[model samples]
Target: MSYSDTNDPAFESMGNAAHYTNIASTLFFAYAVVSFVKDDANDPLFDKSWKQDGFCVTHKEIPFWNSHDACLYFDMMAALLLGALYWKQRNALGMERVNEIFGPSILGILAHGIGHGAVAHRMREMGLPTLAEEDDLDKTTIDENINERIMEINMMDDILGVGEVSERGRNVFVMVCFWVGLMKAALPNLRMAPFAAMVLAAMAGQQFVDRQFAFTYVQTILLVAFSVNQLARKKEEKDFVYATHPMVVGVPVTFIGWIESTQCSAFVKDSFYGHLIYDGFIPVAMLVWYVVCYLQIKESRDNSFESIAKTADRKGKVKVS
Candidate 1:
């Protein structure tokens, strides 16, 4: 009758981790929002661009500065709310409570995975074109394609009934918002080198330990992978679909960075065996998971085939019935 016997801790830990992540996320986000509100001025980077095609000039301004800001604020708010809920229920909820949060957590993870994955795939499919080539693509066409994909993914979620957005998407949105807000507020003059370093550290932390601990690690890895893959393939990689694609190079690297960050942090720094708990461990774990899932799926298929084949063979042996 004990809760320990009835529920799995692995599932529960995910929820607890997510709850803590939300707490940190909220603090960062609040800082972002207050900073933005106080400094509502626009930067030159936000300027629009114009392209001329024959006699016509097309003008484009990036969408939703305000909306992006709002999303960042709201994402932080959501994280804070989740943190509060976790704090309230930590003692009474047990593993089931943690398990319950997995649905949302996974959804967030998948969202981020797909969004960036798709972008990488698309860039690859586009053949690693120059900025000019990318600009040449009709913005509306690109937007439509993105919208279509988003809709298709949304439908898949609807069928699954897990929640609205995928985990990856939520992660990407929230992380991006956090980064943008941070840049806008505290690090307005941030250089690429320092930004890259932060990204590397954050990525190292997230992949090895937990993503919530440091989200930027994921972004850094994604960008670097995309750059490297474009160089290696000599052709654009395919637009990312759901499965693990060539663009997945980012995942492992970021995971490594995250692990590093976790170990360095105050809470985990002195923990036992912390030295062995680097982000490098993530790849080994992922490889194991991949093999296990593949083997299980293959076994199921093989068994299904055997069952059908046996049934047919039995029927063949029988007289006309």
Candidate 2:
């Protein structure tokens, strides 16, 4: 059947998801760049001393425009946008389309929320204030001395610091990316959903896993498995795009991500450049591939029309004869 004649709602959903995802990816990428840039003073991203008042708007206690919280906020916003887009178009797109687009997303969002909540709980358990509950210290008159409150605020960074929260957000972002990609590829299954979640959990569960690069190794093994599975299911069909086409690319792309994450990749050793190349390369490449695929399909369709016209002309001449 022709592409336009395709009644497959799932295919249409994939198209919509890809359209929005490309935009989301680009926006996130721009933020990622700004987030990774080191200041002239050589302080790490989000590493600033708390104000003497102890709870200013820019304080780390709340989610500021810093690298860590920015990532979390951006991912949450994008995911909500994706869901809203699908929901608003649901009547036209149908149930299969809606489920395909929203299934992994809802799950991924819950996972991220839970991850953040767990960290917050840990912080409170350690006697660290979860967030700045009060307004600016100037607004609220407290009996406690200024120095005591400042000391407490300093401990906030010490106990409930940037590392775990940012790491968790990063893992959630990666998980969401994979989830959306799998949905777009029309490869979402019962197994794949949990597998993606498992990878996310494992990557974030660094405190549990003492071994270095364990997450990378796990991701590498998963990609290989997915590639092999897709290849094994290969079939001969002109109209059908092989799911394995993108699946195979994922194997090498994932390996590149792994390499870039480690110091072993010296040419771009885990710097801002490496992060950009690692995160940005595959999406851009896939986008170019999509455009080429569209052109090829258009050419094939035009050729098909020409062949039909020629056959009809020949038949008409025979009727005249």
Candidate 3:
């Protein structure tokens, strides 16, 4: 089953995508689980994300554990999977793909986890509201301008008011990840697509760091289109699952990501429970992707087929006799 002599150019690409899908799904599922389980009542004041006066803390204040902590742990899981995935593929598919396929996305997500950790630490050190309402803040304890501080989290656009440098740095890095990914893709390097997708995801995302309503739909639709294209292919490779399964995870990830934006009346979109459900879905979607990826890689190793019939299609891959 080793693909050492396979003629398909997509061997490495498919292998790498499966790996990414695994991490992404697990990371996403963690986000969802944490959101559901994090109980303000169970938390001591020190561990909660709100201040004494009811203002929202900018940091993920839990000492040993928090959402960022969950993400880092997931990143560790990703590292392990990456190591295993890399080892298998390099031996079977060839070592030449090691850096070219796996390096950037893995590194990007790791950096993203580090950035989140930094933001959490730095913001906790500052000890002020990154998100707050005027009523939540006490009038007398601090010297910062109240007008500059108060921002309603309920509104989408008001996130602009958060002026923390660490937060901004994280966002800027996310954008940079996407930009670099685009540059790679511009050269027709499809290998980097997952990295760019991670950029938009806030690193192997079950959650978009900055969520937008219509934007979620676009992501969902595009990924679905990708799945459809793979499914419609006239020639199904031995690695057909490799081509389609990763994209299949996209449907639920986008749907879960879209739930918050739905504003459905029955869903209580304005409630804390709603927030928990939305955040919770992030990890669920991620976990789904992980499962698919795991299956894909396992299948690839077991099903490496030789003598692929190179046929022409509308996309313009040249036909071979």
Q: Report the lDDT tens digits of candidate 3 across residue range 1-321.
A: 443334354744673465355445545533443443244565322222122212122223344244444444565565566556555655443323223434443443454445334433433444444344435655443324421232222112222224677666655555454335322312223445764563344333322323212223223333433344334333433243444345544435444443432332234232433333433343344344444545555555445442232222422554332
Candidate 1, overall lDDT?
Answer: 0.33
lDDT of 1 by residue, 1-321 (tens): 222222223423433333334334434433342333223264111111100100010111222211122222333444355445445644542223222322233233333333333333322333432345557677666544433432232222222223345755754554454333332222223467875565445433443522121233333333343333223321122111112211232244334333433233333223422212322232333333333333444454566679999999899889565
Give the poorly placed runs of model 2, Cα more than 4 Å off. Answer: 1-208, 237-248, 262-276
Better structure of 1 and 2 per lDDT = 2
Per-prediction TM-score, please? 0.24, 0.41, 0.39
Residue pairs whose backbone atoms clash in candidate 2: none
Which candidate should be chosen as best, given lDDT against the real structure? 3
List residue ranges in candidate 3 displaced over 4 A. Answer: 1-59, 93-108, 111-115, 118-122, 129-188, 191-239, 246-248, 259-321
Model 2, TM vs. native? 0.41
Q: Give the poorly placed runs of model 1, Cα more than 4 Å off.
A: 1-219, 223-276, 319-321
> How displaced is residue 290 in candidate 1, in Å?
2.0
Residue-level lDDT for 106 in candidate 3: 46
- Evaluate candidate 2 by giving its C-alpha RMSD to the native, one decimal: 12.8
Model 3 misses residue 209 by how many Å? 11
